[model samples]
Target: MPKLKIEDLARIREQARRATLLREGAGRVKITVHLGTCGIAAGGRNIMTAVLREIEERNLHDVLVTTSGCAGLCSREPMMTVEVLGQPPVKYVDLTEGKVKEIFAEHIVGGKIADRYALAVGSERVM
Candidate 1:
């Protein structure tokens, strides 16, 4: 294979920098995929893959993707929470790859919540 030129290295560096920024909370949106034991048993891995695929396909530099433990709802395993800056986070449950794609397009890209797949919008108030 031919050696990479300085320009190629620069482009790679920029891409890495943008990814770091997203992970550092500089992103406009954050998606947390629940991957607890229960979640995995319910196909959380697939959900995670779908999320990543969507981000890659769309080349979304402003979207951060992460994984988390259960959301205290085992039955709702394989779930995810989407948080858009300046708006409340929305929890979506019982997902499939197809559903994830739709959510990414409608909610993440279009700024509209996917109500059909959403479990709730925002967290419960603390006592």
Candidate 2:
């Protein structure tokens, strides 16, 4: 490999700074998608894609979308946990592409939980 240039280092630093702002900025909403073996097998990846598309379509810069392993609920694969500041996390399960869009609109954008598709509301059962 060739020696690194100062311009390259500067570009990398700027990229890192932007990424940090995107993930750690104030008043940001965090969405975590479960992507363990079972989750993936149940279409977690498609759910994640739908979420990202929704965020982009809405031009939302204050939402941080991330993924994690299973929450030990294999039966509830393709699940996602949404966390907004000053609000208890809501876990939505059994996702499809269309359901993800609905969740994004109602829960993420409209400030109301999509109780229909949600498996739990702050640890209590919904379905």
Best by lDDT: 1
Q: How many backbone clashes does candidate 2 have?
A: 0
lDDT of each: 0.92, 0.86
In model 2, the runs with Cα more than 4 Å from the true position are 1-20, 23-27, 123-127
Model 1 over residues 1-127: C-alpha lDDT tens digits? Answer: 7799999999999988866776566889999999999999999999999999899899889998889988999998789999999999999999999999999999999999999999999987879
State the lDDT of candidate 2 residue by residue for 1-127, as single tens digits. 7788999899989767655767455645889999999999999999989988998788776788889998888997789999987899999988899998998889889999999988876855569
By TM-score, who's the top model here? 1
What stretches of model 1 exceed 4 Å from their correct place?
1-16
- Candidate 2, pairs of clashing residues: none
